[model samples]
Target: MKHEIRFIINGESRSLTVLSQQTLLEVLREDLGLTSPKHGCSTGECGACSVLLNGEVVNSCMVLAAEVDGADILTVEGLATDDELHPLQKSFIDHHGVQCGYCASGMLISAKALLNRTSRPHEEEIREALVGNLCRCGAYADIIKSIQVASRARR
Candidate 1:
C-alpha cells in the first residue's frame, strides 16, 4: 500500500508517496535522491544508514517510511550550508576521520546527534554514541578526535 506523507527534511518540507514496506533509507536514497544515508546493513546492525529523526540518531534502514509521516529527518546533506561546512565536517577533515567514504556519512550523523544533545560529550560518551557505527578503515581514533575537535571549536 502507498501512503502520502509530509515531513521536514533538511529544513525543507517534503511530501511523497511511500510504500508501506519501504524503509526510510529506501525512500531517502531512491525516491528523494538523498544518498548521504548509505545502505550497509539492512538489519540495523551497521549504522551506515544513520540519520537524525527529530534530532535523534537512528538507523534509517530500520525505520519504515510510512511510520515517519510528519516527522523531521536530517541526512548528512542537511548539515552544511552553501557557503560553509558544519563544524563536524571541518573537524572530520582536520582530524582525518573519513576514509573509504562508506561509513563517513553515518559516522558524521551520529556525531552530529551527540553534539546537538551534549554539546561537549566525554570521550566515553562519544564512544557509546558511535558504538553502532563501524568504520571499515579503522579510523576510530581519528573519528573520536574529530568529535572532540568539533566540540572544542564550537565552544
Candidate 2:
C-alpha cells in the first residue's frame, strides 16, 4: 500500500508517497535522491545507513518511511550551509576520520547527534555514542578524535 508521508527534509517541507514496507533508506535514496545514506547492511547491523530522525540518530534501514510522517529528517547533506561544512564535517576531514567514504555519512551523523546532546563529551561518552557505528577501514581512533576535536571547537 502507498502512504502519504509529510516531513521536513533537509530543512524543507516535503511530501511524498511511500510504500508501507519501504525503509526510510530506500525512500531517501530512491525517491528523494539523497544518496549519502549507504545501503551497507539492510539489517541495521552496520551504521552505514544512519540519519538524524527528529534530532536522534537512527538507522534508516530499520525505520519505515511511513513511520516518520510529520517528523524532521536530516541527512548528511543538511549538515552544511552555503558550501560551508559543519564543524564536525570539517573536523572529520582534518582528523582523517573518513576513509573510502562508504561509512562517512553515517559516522558523521552519529557524531553530530553526540555533539548535539553533549557539546563537550569525553572520550568514553563519544565512544559510547558511536558504539552503534562501525568502520571497516579501522578508522575508529581518528573518528573518536574528530568528535573530540569538534567538541573542543564548539567550546
Candidate 3:
C-alpha cells in the first residue's frame, strides 16, 4: 500500500507517495535522493541514518515515512546556509571529527539537535546527546571536541 505524505524536508515542502512499510531513510535516499543519511544499520543501532524530525534527533531507519506527515525534517544538507557552513560542520572538519565519514551526517544531526536545545552544552551533555551515534573510526574524542568548539562558536 502506498500513502501520500506531506512534510517539510530540509526546509522545503515535499509531498510524495511512499510505501506504507517504507522507512524514512528509504524515502529520503531512494525517493528524494537525499543521500547524506547513510544506511549503516537497518536496525537503528548504528545511528548512521539520523535526522532531525521536528528538531529532535531520530534514527531515520526506525521512523516510517508515513509517520512524518506534516512534520518538519532536517537532514545534514539543511544545516548550511548559502554563505557558510554550519558551525558544527566547520568544527567537524577543523577538529578531524569525521574519520571514515560514514557517521558524519548522523553525528552532525545529533550535534545540531543538542546545540538547538542548549547553546552551551556541557561535555557530559554532548556525550549524552550522541550516545546513540556510533563512530566506527573511534573518533569520539574529536567529535566531542568539535561539538564543544561549535557550542562556543555559537555563543
Candidate 4:
C-alpha cells in the first residue's frame, strides 16, 4: 500500500508517495537521493542514519516515512547553504572531527540539535548529546572538540 504525504525537507516543501513500512532513511536515500545519512546499522543503535525530524535528532532508519506527514525534516545535506558550510561543518574540518566519515553526518546533526538548544554547551553536555553516535575511528575527542568549538561560535 502507498500513501501520499507532504513534508518540508531542507527548507523546501515536498510531497511523495511512500509505503507504510518504508523507513524515512529509505525515502531520503532511495527516493529523494539524499545520501548524507549513511546506512550503518539498520537498528537504532548506530546514529549513522540520523536526521532532524522537526528539529529533533532522530534515527531515520527507525522512523516510518509514511508517518512524516506535515513534518519538517533536515538532513546533513541541508547543513550548508549558498556554498557556505555551517559552523559545525567548518569546526569539524578544522578540528579533524571526521576520520572515516561514516558517522560524521549523524554526529553533526546531533551536535546541531544540541547547539540549537544550548549554544554554549558544557563538555559533559556535548558528550551526552553524542552518546548515541559511535565513531569507529575513535574520533570522539575531535568530534567533542568540534561540537564545543561550534557551540562557542554560536554565541
Q: Using Cα atoms with residue i matched to residue i, what is each candidate's TM-score against the true structure?
A: 0.98, 0.97, 0.98, 0.98
lDDT tens string, model 4, 1-155?
89999999999999999999999999999999999999989988889999999999999999999999999999999999988999999999999999999999999999989988987999999999998898989999999998988888876
Per-candidate clashes come to 0, 0, 0, 0
lDDT of 1 by residue, 1-155 (tens): 99999999999999999999999999999999999999897888889999999999999999999999999999989999998999999999988999788999999999998888898899999999998999989989999999998998997
Model 2, 40-150: lDDT tens digits are: 988778899999999999999999999999999999999999979999999999999988889889999998898888879999998898888889998899989988998
**Candidate 4, RMSD to the unseen true structure:** 0.7
The segments of candidate 3 whose C-alpha lies over 4 angstroms from its true place after superposition are none
The lDDT, on a scale of 0 to 1, for candidate 2 is: 0.92
> How far out, in Å, is residue 8 in model 4?
0.3
User: For all the candidates, what are their Cα RMSDs to the real structure?
Assistant: 0.7, 0.8, 0.8, 0.7
